[model samples]
Target: MSVNEIDEQGLGPQARRSEATKRALLDAALADMEATGEASIRITKILQESGVTNGSLYHHFGSREGLVQAAIAERFLGSVTKGLAVFAHRVGEVGSTEQLFEVFRDELVRIGSPDVQTQRIHRMTALAAALPRADLLERIIADQGRYFDGAADSLARLQEHGFIRFDVDVRAFAAWFLGLSLSRLLSDIDPQLNPDNEWSEYTFRALVAILTPAPSAH
Candidate 1:
């Protein structure tokens, strides 16, 4: 199920090579999605761009939808996990709740922006899966669940250590954070959703405020 599992099961070498090929295919698909924010992406172009063999593609992912799901899961999960790790680390490093939240706000904005067309399209496709393939949508949600649980674990640790406020619900916050991100994904389709590029900043600040302890009066 995981990379480690693949290694432990005696499929390490082949899995490692296949993983590289998978990354190439994902990167190629991203390039296509970035170029055009279309959900119905062309499979031939991705194969050509990645130079992945037809047999290999079919072997690794059985269907066009499967390939799309794998690529989206890998890319989106990587970013979510990476950003959450840093945010949690920063939480432990900072003393005050304000300082900790500043770190979170910065991470939120940074991760959400610099507007890469590829990422927007990738997100649209993932969200689009909800309509045509409920099964695929479930897979994407499950993929995110693993990373969100990891982040919630870190938050629980911080709360236990008194780095974060004890009253805050870590898992709920993670769900809310992800829900906000998905809602923001629609902003690309209709800028009306974002309103002024302030959604990330505003939401980050609001959520952190709720999670922080009430300041002690002098």
Candidate 2:
């Protein structure tokens, strides 16, 4: 069952209300970060925007840093995971390597698009913030493991159908794909350096080469 279902089934009225307040505070925190374009949010502003009490914030999150971490996990990372799920579902429907390549090519374009770039920036900012906090970093690592595992499962299905090389590790390939996509951040900082077409073609070629099965000797 989903988190929301559990919340509804298990929580008392007061507990549900508290959860609502927590949600409000998290929403306010994320909104403030997005508006300011900064990962470090002001607790006072969040409390004001959320109409949640300072004591309540401390009671729920323990500290401002805790609130920020939770916000990043729930909003920024959550968005990335949701997008991955959709992409994985699309991958599962592909009937051939050519169709899979088309799916990936479209994904490459989508990832470098302005909207996805903004999302990537937000997620990277969250990761940067989490780097200094061991607990947050651990949480992020665990989340990423699950995300990559789901992606690997999708790729495994393609492998079973002879659409991908049997020798390749799908989990590692998933991680590599993520790294390649995130590397666009280097170009993102420069306005004059749009290497979308070149990057996509090169990466797609590499992907095809890596996934194509070797010929068997007669």
Best by lDDT: 2
Q: What is the C-alpha RMSD of each candidate to the true structure, in Å?
A: 5.0, 3.4
- Give Cα distance to truth, residue 74, candidate 1, Å: 2.5
Q: Which run of 10 residues does model 1 get worst, by summed lDDT?
A: 114-123
How high is the lDDT of residue 133 in model 2?
83
Clashing pairs in 1: 34-118
Which candidate number would show the highest TM-score if scored against the true structure? Answer: 2
What lDDT does each candidate get?
Answer: 0.68, 0.84
Q: Candidate 1 residues 71-188, lDDT tens each? A: 6666566556655677667765776666767777676666566553344445556566544667766776786788678778867876776667788788887887766665665564
**Candidate 2 structure quality by residue, lDDT tens digits, 15-94:** 78898999999999888888765455888888888899999999999998788889877655675786697789899799
Clashes of 1: 1
**TM-scores of all models?**
0.72, 0.89
